[model samples]
Target: MPEGPEIRRAGDRISRALVDKEIVKSNFYYVRIKDREEIVKNKNIKEITTRGKAMLIRFKNGWTMYSHNQLYGRWTVNLNTTKIKSTRALRVVFKTKKHTVRLWSATDIDLLPTSEEHEHSFLKKIGPDVLNESCSYKLIEERLTSKTFHKKKASTLMLDQTVFAGLGNYLRSEILFDAKIHPDDRPFDLDKTRITQWAKSIKNISHLAYKTGGFTVSKYIADRNKENGEPRKSYRHAVFMRYQYECLNCKSRIERKWYGKRKLDFCPSCQIQTGKIKPSR
Candidate 1:
């Protein structure tokens, strides 16, 4: 699934191609979006930005277009290309004379008045975008210390968009590994200093993911790349997708287990847990 950084990057590309340009044509393949032709036709795109995993296309007339590329959605922007071939469903298209912006396979797309954009059902529920420069560390720390969230497993809390948006399975595992915290550890079990450290890791990894196009390898592994030795693609992450593989730091075998239908990866030695973590494929 595309996370916040990926979505933000896509929005940046689309914005560079279409922002400030009046949409001369618009098309939609999804039934929900087709009826909104009159609403978006000929509207000038004031901005294209992302909030968490959601993409926002704001127009000059106080109307915004929201699109969420859940797990399978993708966007393509083309300039001066006459023909394009795509195997994915061409869900939404916005065209100007010089560029074509397409959202492929996106399941959620809505046109809402600017006054109500904040009140959109999904947008209203999600927390602040972690990739946003203005994302509040204090707010997330408060969430960690909150009575309702304190008892939840750290892994589960990391995946909760309502707590802090834009984290998915891979990022969560990487973040926890970076913090040296077990996925099953309750937030309340961690000291305030440890909670703050984990919070900083979240922001650091989130920024690194944005800057490096989702690479979250440790400095040691990344340094190997600088030494003229290419890190194997299969061993890219410290723990994620490295089930039964040796840990990058301790040499102990990395483990994987199902956490809410999603795989959680970690080194048993690195991520200390209260009880034994049963490993599965």
Candidate 2:
């Protein structure tokens, strides 16, 4: 599944291709909204934004188009002259003067008034967006200390979009590994300093992934790994998918535990459990 960074990047691409440009034509192949596609015809796209894994396309008017790329959705942009073979999976098309932007395979789509967008099921309860400039360490720290989320396990909370928008499974693993916090630890189990580190890690790792095209490691390390003939899938992250391998920070073997049906990886020596109280950094 595409995580927050991936979705945000998609939004950036769509924004660059369509924002401010008058849509000469718009097509929604999505069954329910296909007939209502005239709503955006000849209108300018005011802005395009992402909240976690969902994309919002705001028109010059008060309307907003929402789409979630649950698992298979993808968006592609090309010049108007470029030819893309038609497929049954095609979901949306926005043809501007110079470029054609297409959304494929997205099912959870809606068109709603921007004024009432707050009522969206997913957006209504989403926590601070880690990539948003306004979502700072102070905001995350407050959320961490809040009674509503204080008792949840870090492993569980990391995947909870209500706790931190844009955080998914891969991010959950990378952030916890970066902060050197055990997956089993709760916000209440962490000291003030540790909690601060956790907040910082959530922001840093998330932004880094966005900046580096989903890489959690530094450019130097990534380059070194590539030089060693390591595939991106094996080197793009720290503990995620690297289970049973040596940890990047510590030489301890990485371990994976099942959270229901999902997998979570951690380094036993680096991310010490709460009772052990070993400071990682």
Candidate 3:
């Protein structure tokens, strides 16, 4: 699944390639979207943005094209000609004078009135975008500790898009690991300072992942990996997909268990359930 960062990065790349460029043509390989080509055809793309894991391509005529790369969806930008690998999987296409932006394997594509976009089903349920500069830690804390959510497991709440949009499976593990909070614990179990610290972790990890292209491990671990000649991709994560491997901090074997069909990894020694909770700086 392409999480928020990957989706946002794709939007950025598409915006760079197609923004302000007049759409000379629009193509839809998916049956549901076949009739919606008129929405973007012969119009200019004013902007491209991401809300949660969904992408929006705003046009000069006040119409917006919304697409979500759920699971297997991906977008590609090509110069002059299309760079589609599999024609059968192609879902949507936009052709400008210099570039062609193609979306493949994505099923959630729709046309929406720009003014009514906020009422869209998926967009309406999403919480604050973690990567947005305006994402508020206080708001996140309040939501996490709210009466409706305080009883839920921390892991579950983190994965809930309605609580913090754009957070995916791996990100949930990394965020909890960085905060030194056990996934099974409730947010109410922590002190106020700890809640604020957890919120900070969410923001910091989100920004760092976006800025560093999905690297979630701290600088020390990253530098150590480089010095040891380890591959960049091998150490990009802290506790994600590291089952049975040594912990980066405590040297203990990383543990994994299924959390509602999702494999969650953590350092048992580092993230103990009962202890004095310390604020993560």
Candidate 4:
């Protein structure tokens, strides 16, 4: 699944391609929403924005289209003359006179009132988006101290939409590694310095990944790895998929452990824990 930054970047692309442009033609291939295609046809797009992992496409009228690109869902935008060959099922398409914008393999789509876009179930429940300019340190710090989230395990809380909208597996691992905090630790277990690091890391890594196309390591490291002919996986992260590899900071092995259903990567020594963290593939 695409994280918040990825979704936000997609929104930026879609906005440039579709916003202010009239949807001269459109289609809704999903069985349930097929009839709703009429709603998007021939309308001027107002904006495209994202909340967490969901995308909202607003029309000039009082309506907005909501969609979430789960694991396989993708968006393609290009000149109508250009054809994108793909095996993914096409779910939605919006055509402006000069461009063809498509949403493929996505099913979580809905049309709702523009006035109530924020009230949409998925949008309503998610926490502040890291990429949103409104997400300030104070806002994140407040969440860190909130009772509803403070007690949750750091590993679990990182993926909770209500905790940090747009956070997901890979980003979770990178953020934890950057903060040097154990996933098993709750916010309540954090010292003031650790709490600050946690919050800052969330903002920094999310923004960095958004700017660098999902790579979490520093540009210097990434460029160095590239110059050295290292594969992307070797330099794109500090620890995310580098199991059995040396930690960038401490040189300890990057350990991979299963917590619930997701695998978390961390440096056993860099991220301190009193008890042994059971390792699994």
TM-score of 3: 0.92
lDDT of 1: 0.83
Which pairs of residues have clashing backbones in candidate 2?
Answer: none
Q: How much lDDT does each candidate structure score?
A: 0.83, 0.89, 0.84, 0.86
Give the clashing residue pairs of candidate 1, or none.
Answer: none
Task: Put down candidate 4 lDDT per residue, 1-281, tens digits, no spaces.
Answer: 88888898999998898888767888778876666767766688888888889998888877888999989889988999996889899988889889998999987888888999878888888889988889987788789879988888888989999888999999999999999888888888776788888899999999999998899998898787577666787678888877887787877888998987789999889888624545567
| Ranked by lDDT, top first | 2, 4, 3, 1
* Reference-based TM-score of each model: 0.90, 0.95, 0.92, 0.93
Candidate 4, number of clashes: 0
RMSD (Å) of each candidate, 1 decimal: 4.3, 2.0, 2.9, 3.9
RMSD of 2: 2.0
- 2 or 3, greater by TM-score: 2
How would you encode candidate 3's per-residue C-alpha lDDT over 1-281 as one tens digit per residue?
A: 98899889999999998898778887767777667776666688899999889999898899898899898898988997544457548887788889888888888888878998999899999888988888889888888899989989987988899888899988888988888888888987878887888899898888788877888987888787567665665478888877776888889998986887998888888888845555589
Candidate 3 clashes between residue pairs 3 or more apart in a chain or in different chains: none
Best by lDDT: 2
Worst 10 residues of 3 by lDDT: 80-89
How well is each residue in 1-281 modelled by candidate 1, as lDDT tens digits? Answer: 98887888898889888898767887767888677767877788898888889998988888888999998999988885768977988888889899988888888888888789889999999877888878767777887889878899988898899988898888888889998889989888877887987888788888887877777875667666446444454345677877777777898988887976899899889898845555568
Candidate 4 is scored at a TM of: 0.93
